[model samples]
Target: MSSYFITGVARGLGFEFVRQLSTNPANTIIGLVRDKTATEKKVSEELSGRKNVHLIQGDMVDYASLKKAVDEIATITGGKLDYVIANAAFLSVWAAFEPFSLLAKEPEKLEKELVDMFTVNVVGNIHLFNLITPLVLKGNGKKIIAISSGLGDQEMAINYELFQNAPYSISKTALDMAVAKFHAEYRKDDVLFMCISPGMVDTGYIDPETALLNDMIGKFMKYAPDFNGPTPIDVAIQRILSVMDKSSVEAGDGGKSLSQFGNKQWL
Candidate 1:
């Protein structure tokens, strides 16, 4: 039996991860969310009778809440955690569809958005990882996964000239490097730290009728001609778990940023 801790388990891919992982009755699943009562209600409504699942109230941007969460998780899992998935992040709609050139017109708003994204996406995860490393070191699985984005890839951005979502991409790129640095330090202890891209999962965030979204889709098509759209959430989670299961420090997977397909094929 393994113990897994995932953040932002209220909806989207985070919820899907808990849903899939908790299917195994022996697996202890601890989900961190900003609202405990609300997420517990959702879990009860949808994933009924899953006694192994637990929810903790915590916000990624709040260090005190995250610290308390680590203490609570220690009590729940007997001071050991097998897996820690850093999935909580901030995505800015203001910068989603525009390049930095256009976004720079509103300097104040752009600065705020960039700072907010970096705080939650990069700094917050660093705090979470630092707090949870001890528990992970004591556990058997010894794996840490950061959910990153393909848009952070420098080569891909330059090749396709994809300039949208600058703030989010910059934050994720920083997050990847942070994860790599953690891996560099922790690999000696056999803890596998890696970033995995979910590869454009459809979480109902995109409205097909939106002109900007369509324009992004056009850019994607230019990159991958056969790209129909985002993959289903369940399929994406399955592929990610498969990759995670197959990866290990001994196999040289530590410090690497891999896609769900276990390589650089983003979408």
Candidate 2:
């Protein structure tokens, strides 16, 4: 049985990742969530009678709280994590709404919004990766995966449909660099890590306008055949499983793989 640790387990992609992995008795999943009050109960309700699922309550901002959760999971499971997914993200829809003239807008609101954007989308994620890397080092498996977007690839930026997600795109691009650093630092350990772009999943976290625009451009981008495509939560979980299966891991190094029409890409 393989064990995995994941953050942002409250809803959307994180919840889906937990759901997909919990179905198998042999797979153990430790999920970290922010909404301590409700998410835990909902997870219990949504996934009842599953002994393999372990829920940890916390957020990416507070290291002490997050570390406690990590320690508990490690102690309980005996530190056998096969994969550590830094999937907890900080994102705000307002980042994409920037106009040609920020000087015309209310400076306070705009400033607050952008600060919130950087705090969550960028800073919080860096904290998450830094907090969990040691656990990944202590774990048994040789895999670490970070959730990223195609827009993060600077070389392919113009070719992507990143919208106006300045903070998100920039943060993810930074995250890719962090993953590369980890890979380089641990080169002799025989471990593999990758930052993956999971496609335009409907996680319901995006702005309605952004979603509509993305969908309109989806045709040009060669969206999945079903058109309806996979929801953010569902596709995220499926991709994790697909990537973990040894048959899918023919190449030992878990380099960057992007998914568009359910097929993996290297970029």
Candidate 3:
């Protein structure tokens, strides 16, 4: 039997992780969402009678909430946690790259964007890891997976013209290095830390107010040419889980950022 804890389980990739992982009766799934009342009914309705799944309250930017959730999880799991998926992130903000450039007139806005992005994407994940490391160290699996993005890749950003969403892109790059740091510190203790890109799965979060949605689609087409659009949530999660199952420190998978295609072809 294995125990799993996933954040941002109210919707999107986090919800999918809960769905797929809960299917196995041998696994116990604990999901963290920002709003308990908001998600309780929906999760109960969708996952009816799935006793393997449990929901708790958490917010990525709020370390106190996460610590409380982890304390509860520790009691429930008896101090053993097989996996901790740092899947919660703040990606709701999108801005053009040029606007956030060094020469931009509005330095305040750029600073605010960077601060917001890093608070949730980088600092939050780090705090989560620190709180949960003890339980992970006690488990046999000892794996930590942070959901990252292909846009964070410096080379890919240039080649694919990923000039939009500068704050988000930059934050993810910082997150990748943080994961590497965690791996370096914990590898000796048999804990593995890594990041994975979900490969543009569409979750219907498009904003019609700004051209960001359409602009992103157009840029994706230019990058992949043959690519149509984002992958289905279920399909993307399945591939992601496959990669997670295959990862190992002995194979040099730890401390690396990977894609759906695994370590060799990072997104």
- Candidate closest to the true structure, highest TM-score: 1
> Evaluated with lDDT, which candidate comes out highest?
1
Report the Cα lDDT for residue 31, model 2: 87
TM-score of each: 0.98, 0.80, 0.92
Question: In model 3, what is the error at residue 152, expressed in angstroms?
Answer: 0.7
Locate the minimum summed-lDDT window of 10 residues in model 1.
201-210
Per-residue alpha-carbon lDDT of model 3 for 119-228, expressed as tens digits?
A: 99999999999999999999978999999988788887787676777888899999999999999999898788999889888787754455556766676787677777
- Which candidate, 1 or 2, has the higher lDDT? 1
lDDT of 1 by residue, 97-200 (tens): 98888999999999999999999999999999999999999999999999999989998889888998999999999999999999999989999999999998
Give the worst 10-residue stretch by lDDT in candidate 2. 258-267
Worst 10 residues of 3 by lDDT: 94-103
**C-alpha lDDT (0 to 100) for residue 32 of candidate 2:** 85
How many pairs in model 3 have backbone atoms within 3 A of each other, for residues 3 or more apart or on separate chains, i.e. clashes? 0
Q: Which residue pairs overlap in candidate 3's backbone? A: none
Model 2: how far residue 127 lies from native, Å: 3.7
Q: In order, what lDDT does every prediction score?
A: 0.93, 0.66, 0.86
TM-score of 2: 0.80
The C-alpha local distance difference test score for the whole of candidate 3 amounts to 0.86
Model 2 accuracy (lDDT, Cα): 0.66
